[model samples]
Target chain A: MNATREELSEKGKKRRDFITLTATAMGGVLAGSIAWPLLQSMNPAADTLAESITEVNLAPILSGAALTVIWQGKPVFIRHRTQQEIAEAEDAPMSALPDPQTDKSRVLKPQWLIVTGICTHLGCVPLGQKKTEPRGEYGGWFCPCHGSHYDTSGRIRKGPAPTNMIVPPYTFVKEDLIRIGESS
Target chain B: MAKQSQNPYRHPFVRWIEHRLPIISFFEHTLKHYQVPKNLSFLWTGGFIAGFMLVVMIITGILLAMHYIPHPDHAFDSVERIMREVNFGWLIRYLHANGASLFFLVVYMHMFRSIYYGSYKSPRELLWIIGMIIFLIMMATAFLGYVLPWGQMSYWGATVITNLFTAIPWVGDSILEWLLGAPYVGAPALNKFFALHYLLPFLMFLMVFIHVWALHTNGSNNPTGVEPKTAEDTIPFHPYYTVKDLLSITAFMVIFAFFIFFAPNFFGEPENYIPADPMVTPAHIVPEWYFLPFYAILRAIPDKLGGFVAMISSILVLFALPWIDRSKVRSLTFRPISRALFWVFILDVIILGWAGAKPAEGNYIIIGQFATAYYFIHFLILVPLVSRFEKPSGLPESLSAYYKNSCHD
Candidate 1:
């Protein structure tokens, strides 16, 4: 451990440093070139990427009723918020929630509340998409897998979930039609 | 240099090339004359066996990959065809699959050897850390490879694991979507997993190279935990250790061959032979046998994120082991308290693995919770506290002294 090699002369050391730096730069270039193609392969296939956007008719969903639709194989909750339901979501104290988001900010229209049904905790589908299931303390979704409570605005209210449910990229095309996956 | 000139092994053409490349001299310096502590036990041979297992795995994996179709619809069918139709495909497939189990078994034994000898402490810290990294990547590689057969367990296991990521705060869903490449485990998930599974083993190969480099840097810690003081206490690696390692590898191969020829499905789930159907999850969606201990830790916790953190931390905590037990002695042979604790820790892990395979109900949960607690406590508290109070046995002066005193004991 104590043995030392013969020290390099000044010019020799400079040449060694130059070679090391040059070799490093060449290695970086080679790595990037190889990585680019490999990374590109990981992107979604064209057929699957095309299915990323889905259109749903709003006429079938009655007011206060939430309909579950499949977009990119995930359950998208499209709720036709009734006047009362809208007021209930709007009147809730935003500052008191774990993840604070105003009811208006989540939806393009006051009558619609569309969010991904997947829970923010462990990705299980929350149970309140159906009228028969428990809607938690808040009149929204409750994930039975883990006790995550979400408010009507889809903001996480209580439990281990750290944030609100995801709202997929969506836009309202007409009063009776909406599209999920492509944002306005 | 003068002695080598007289050796017949150095051919005239080779000597001519050696002047230009010095490749032969590199091998002579690194392998032939490399000095190792003379007292290393049969346990020390596990590393060599593991290296041989890696080569076996890579060759068999490449052969299996030649016929494997990564699509969800065809993966199970393709594996079946390889087993039934392709020439000697069953041998290659069994060797690769069973090789994975043997690899894990060898690695675990090697790891326990290190822990028992306190090989993770002090100057060897970085070496141990690199080993832990290799283990982490090995687990990831095995997990992804397990999914390639596209069985019922494969689909649900992928589902369960990928979903565990969603327990993360804000970016969970996006990460899950990106990982799956679709909303759920499908063709894209299978394709990317296959690519990553194929890729990680090469990374492991590079890591093994660095691991050896680090090992040679510090030489080796022997069973006596005493450093060699003179050339008399050491031997050249060329013939002594090489023969020892070769004998151990031959013994390992016999076991490996037996499994391949006689009991190909011994370590595997029968449900895995069934094609993956997302509609029907197998009653027990357990991972491979080797993953059971960590899986038990994950299920021990009731909270989703907590379980995720616990499962991950169980492995990550080993990275801290070099600093955790501030002991002067290197081997458990001298440390009475720690030696007892080490065996208890081993028993706890085995129990945890058993608990993991069983349903998480009634007594299994109780057993799991206790074992999980003991695991953390063993590392965090028992190790440090025991080192402080327990008086270690007297270490001999040298390797020669220890050999002479063996009969006296």
Candidate 2:
């Protein structure tokens, strides 16, 4: 009877050990399964956030008119110039501006009234030049924020602004539609 | 041990020097004296994984700086030149960029692992706090480094973030100017940011040392959440933990390599391709995704100072976690209520992240407010309260209880 009792006790001990081992293993597996997916899920979302592009519309403004749109929270001005403005822009002397360029080089094939809008100075938005101002041999938007003036070509003619207004990469969607965010 | 006596050059001075610096002896002592819980599972590897990523960031950051130019005029063109002409420049840049996301990924897991296992409790409180410090420094370093590329996102991201200080009541403008070294986020800001970004990692490295020291001081918290009480319950640190840590690191590298090689551009902003134009702002100026949750918190409050306070408090609250949790039990396995609350916390963080990505409009603000409130509640109220009222399953009486209990059947 003593031997039989000892044998029963031994068997019970082994069974309990097995159960504990199994529970521990199960716990590890559960932890791992949860953690692996959590770690993996973090990667794809970050990738998607980084590589995504945005689109901007440029159809509302008429020729010789400028409008502002916020991209990444900074204001970007898109100006549309009429055909006459484009012709007049060419007569502006390259010597008068910080960066001198002909219309063919600055704007895309046909749509013109120089597309650049950034102020060359400290980057504040420059107020638009009114139509009544003397062409000053070059007719374009004048930035009133500082005294910086530009001819129709969007070249920096006079003032503290260092560079001519930037010409952003844009493409026409249709006769009137223009996509400003990405190049085709 | 006396075998060195055969060599006459092994004089008293040499012996004293050897005794003082005894690296071999130190290793032996570490191997012998250091005891780890025998039941530690894979979750323990997250800490090491995070440490490894920190090293990777520092290494890649230093290399990237070799070709990087900090001046605003040259910064954009220089980065372009690196991508186009510099040897393996693209590889270095992508690695550094992707490395930031991976570092944060590992760190969050490391932190969560600490939370779930109750690693932050009692004697290990200092370790957890040190880890939090590392997290904060990492955030600052990554933020500054993001501006180095001088892309559209870089410029506007800097602009918006620097403007945050301007929310301060009286000296806000001066503070902003001080940070920029100029009236605006221009050349001076970029230059100074580069200098500081270059310096912060070394500081991170020192803090990591402290983190490890504190970790070792308390020993590692294990999966069972039960502290080891005797030799029978512990194993030597070398063969047991070294092998496990190495295996897990190897596994982590495989995933890291997969991103570095295949999906390099996956985490970068497309607007960054355009050079920064101050006058021409991109419509949506979002920071890097890692910062989204905090950014969400920043925008959550309608008031400027209130938003800033809320944003900072979100991080500051983490430092108080160790004390706030009142549970006698360390591990969540036995604490049913705490486990449920833990999941709620996770969901709250995710909701905050989602709210961060959405524009602060209409329902999003309400959602953010709710999530932000839940975030604080989880720490300040739920942790302590749940810990106090919840009855934990009784613990094993000693380290050898498992063995004794098994023997008794």
Candidate 3:
């Protein structure tokens, strides 16, 4: 007697296809999940690299001058304002500021305005001083939006801004240069 | 007698719940009768990819939180420690960080897919609206979570964003204080953000469930943009859609893994590694890449309140899309003018994202304002105007006709 061939119905074929596709997809997901951690393990050095403080050269910056640099992928605005700017900032009328006394409490050092350049009023990079214009009554930088003003010392002076420009901590290595990452 | 003898292994409560609820029957009904488009291709995978990314974020986030400290003093160091000491900690942190970017990428594509295919029209309106809510919540969750690191970008980014509320007329400062939990973005703010960030995802998960439910309720919009008219136009969701969605998700995972593994920091800001200091400010304080397009919009207008409104309305307009589009026909395939307008909208969005990344000056701001205007016009004016009068090409009577025509050719 001849053997009979069993024909698979369309429904059975579809079921098989569904199971196969699902298994393949799930297998891909599982593979990706496993691979991510493994790849992370291979880059053990990046962890150390990520945490280490970077050394920035401040030699090019003049006293009472500000320059911006990228550290760890964010913009670090380093302003080396001269003693004159600092003194003028201190002498500026207290009534002109939202909070005066140059708020020495906010700065790590009185000289450098180490702030994240982002505006406190919605994260825009406020325009730098316009061509030899003295830092205004608030004395430091001015945010164009809503006219929030920060003193040369990075304190909030006038306008709708809520807080002082962030003063990142730093110690001067020499008269002309400063290191941003480390402090004495 | 045999029938009366119940198996003790089968719990009486299980039987009672099953009989009362008949939840299994509902599953059977969904499986057997829920119609899905058989012609759904790989593009359909974006929704599922977004769903998968959400799950990844929640899982990795929970794990990272176990080791993370909310206190400002400990938070930065704790993140460092996780990177250096904890087993698989670096992996978890990177995945969560990069997963956020991936999630946005997939969602943007999903949103774009909806736009291109007119998936927001008519019956699918609620689904698209629910998806929009998910998008907004995701944005908030991402923003809040970004602040938890207490890094430079985190600190400055938080400061800048939290202060935007003060632009509101009256009660603005009060609202800002309420959000920060203190006068500024400091320890209290970070702690509150951490708490809220942890909580919002659970809420998002619930919203996602609603999004999916709304989607299933209306059924998925397909590439054809043509609504199904008869039984022959659709197939079972189980085998057809399930397979298609799964396949695309797998493909997306491949690309996603490539980024997670090979170049994790490619998209990240380098300055974020520095611990935040209140006194020092960073130059060019830009937001994360995902926020650039809207950021550009915010800057496009010179006026504070005007810019803010325009930026926000850019997103809010998406919710009004179903009503904005006045096309009689559903699909863009038939509408030549609408199709061209769609491409213009895509270009405008890309330009906006690009302009957002650049410094707000010169021609960039000008371009951004123009793009912003067009962005609003695309939905507010172009969609309604062009869709109404623009002539569309021929459309097939049914999915079967479309399928047969393609097969014949």
Candidate 4:
């Protein structure tokens, strides 16, 4: 024992022990506190949060076509699912999904397939919204940045994206109109 | 024991190449197998953040340079064209610009971490010196990069900074002429700045290599500021530090991305958006936020040459710190007085930066002068006096004992 450690009595030693232990714990927690906001700040800021809701007219989107709409600065894909596409998504085997989710679980309605266009691997928007863009092997959205493939239900069928494309919290107000950002 | 391994690489192709070049083993020895103190704090990740920012800056800077025009007439337009015309150029520009601030932020954290732990003392002095050299190069690179935009702040800021050399005694003007390569801060100066901006990062990279070599030689100072005594006290760099660094880097990238996407011009002056105007200087000219503390130090002095010298001396004072501190113990955890004063020094620097942000007038000048004086006093006077008179009696015997709270069996 050194001078201070030597001078302390049994009680003082225990108190000192507690102090050091707390200090170490606090130091770790405080270090954690510094990095907390670094990650948190990446989450949507006030302006993005403020401009959260977006209204999309579903009337213009044809039976097979997908329309991309901006909601809170992220692309939301609203595809008017063709009957054949709906069947493919619903009948697709659970074993094939890299990130498995049933078509019933993914959609609020069978006719409209609404999912965020951003790839789960990175934030790149997958390119199946337009006719010219290749929809990858699964005949769904393809991310050109990487080669992530999503099915008609926006399930991750292949590549780096670990999860299914998110079904953003949205609700159908009118029969032909959908509102995004407000809870369903 | 030092003899080379005949089959360091398991793969036949790798082994064949290793026989000639030996890079695989070099990677293993220097990085993969390199040992570091296991008790290193999250604060230690500051170096990793700095390295990450350097790569970001260099990659973005190279892309910026490809489209950048050196001539003053075209420079501003070229930068505008890059933003408007070139794809993802805005992202690259914002990242490079903001990356400089974050780079300095992390480097300062790294430096302060060293100071707080007394990692600069004794055996690690040269390691600290090499780090300072890297910091100096970083500052130079940042200064040159700021000039490339050829905006109002860019031209006037360059003019003001280059004019500082004119504060030198008989050969001041000659020095200025040599530096500018012209009578005024014009095409020649901008070209030189562009060329040097491209070059300095490579120099900083060399210094960083030497700094790492020195670091590996000295090893790392732990939170307890105690050297490792046994194998248990240290771990291989690959698994522990590599993962630790990635976590910190990911966390840091969030903030970096937040700035790039959300607040691209947060650290930038609005005046810099206006193209270069030599005739009309911005009413309240300020250097980038990273340079503010030194800029405050420069203006604090009444005399031109004195301010310049004092500004330079502010950095030089850090070079003498390992010697100036007379304490036997390294960590401020044991030295309560130094710990308290260390914080006070940080507050003082922040105040100086605040003063620098404001126009140098009245109360700001008075406060800045006091802060500047306190800055030197903290290093030269208070540290030595307090460290000598006060005893750090409860100094821990070993890293394991203090941190692990029990001696290893």
lDDT of 2 at B401: 74
DockQ of 2: 0.04
Q: Write the per-residue lDDT of candidate 3 for residues B250-352, one digit (tens) a residue.
A: 7888887887889888778888899987645455567888898898888787655677788789899899989888886777877888888888888988999
Per-residue lDDT tens digits for candidate 2, residues B1-409, read 4745532335677666555566555666666678888878788888888878878888888887888899989999998888789999888877888989988888888899899989999989989888899899999999899998899989978876776776677897667766776655777678889999999999999998899888878788886687898887789988888889899999988888888899987878899989988765555566788898898787677655677889999999999888899887888877889999999899989999988877656688789889998988888888889999998874566545744665742
Candidate 1's C-alpha runs over 4 A off are A1-47, A51-71, A74-184, B1-10
A38-126: candidate 1 lDDT, tens digit per residue: 86656566787775678999998878788888877667888887788788889988678877888888889888899987776655567
Q: Could you give candidate 4's per-residue lDDT for residues B262-318 as a string of tens digits?
A: 999999999999998653445567899989999888878766677789999999988
- What lDDT tens digits, residue by residue, belong to model 2 across residues A1-184? 6569889999999999999999999999999999988755423233222322335455666667666664433344555777777676666666655676776777775344434455554344455533553333345555432245666666777654445777665667776666665574
User: What's the TM-score of candidate 4 when only chain A is evaluated?
Assistant: 0.77
**TM-score per candidate for chain A alone:** 0.78, 0.58, 0.57, 0.77
RMSD (Cα, Å) for all candidates, in order, is 6.7, 21.5, 16.8, 28.5
Please tell me which predicted candidate would have the highest DockQ against the true structure: 1
CAPRI grade of model 2: incorrect
Error of 3 at B132 (Å): 0.8
Model 3 reaches what TM-score against the true structure? Answer: 0.72
DockQ winner, 1 or 4: 1
True contacts kept of 4: 0.00
